[model samples]
Target: MSSKSEERREHTCISCGINISGTSAAKFDCPECGTLIYRCSKCRKQSNLYECPDCGFTGP
Candidate 1:
């Protein structure tokens, strides 16, 4: 496999910076800027705040 393809997919939780990919990660787009965001189940259950890197829009 190419280096890019061999690389493990890593998706970090926007709120906690924890690796979420390959797990029960919740993926959604930021309401304001539409930037894709990933959140782990733990963080989602707790309703952690997430800020959009593109627009700085924050919400739980």
Candidate 2:
């Protein structure tokens, strides 16, 4: 298994305005702003939260 340090991935959320850590190595980019959103484990019942399916809006 990989070490703890290696397992942790750093990333930032665009819409939520939160610093996400311990994310997966694989991440998704915002369709609208093209902002990178790493897979945040802290996110509740959501992973790689994407913008609206219809419209590519980042924020509310």
Candidate 3:
């Protein structure tokens, strides 16, 4: 089983492609595929576009 740290390492901001392990990132389910999506505070503030890696769904 993977530890919490390992799982955190796997999460990245979909908008910036940056590792969000230690940041106050936002996590949510993709509206199209229900897959988990992460966005860093910076990107979220800028209204950056994010595409769901699983379903190819894009959103602001």
In lDDT terms, which candidate is top? Answer: 3
Residues 1-60 of candidate 2 have per-residue lDDT tens digits of 868776564556543546666444336655676655453444434543546434566432
| Ranking according to lDDT, highest score first | 3, 1, 2
- The TM-scores, one per candidate, come to 0.82, 0.32, 0.81
How high is the CA lDDT of each candidate model?
A: 0.86, 0.51, 0.90
In model 3, what is the error at residue 29, expressed in angstroms? 0.2
lDDT digits (tens) for residues 1-60 of candidate 3: 969776656678999999888789998999998998999999999999998889899999
Structure candidate 3, residue pairs in collision: none
Ten contiguous residues minimizing lDDT sum, candidate 2: 39-48
- Candidate 1 stretches with Cα past 4 Å from truth are 1-8
Candidate 2 C-alpha error for residue 29, in Å: 1.0
All models, RMSD in angstroms: 3.4, 7.4, 2.2
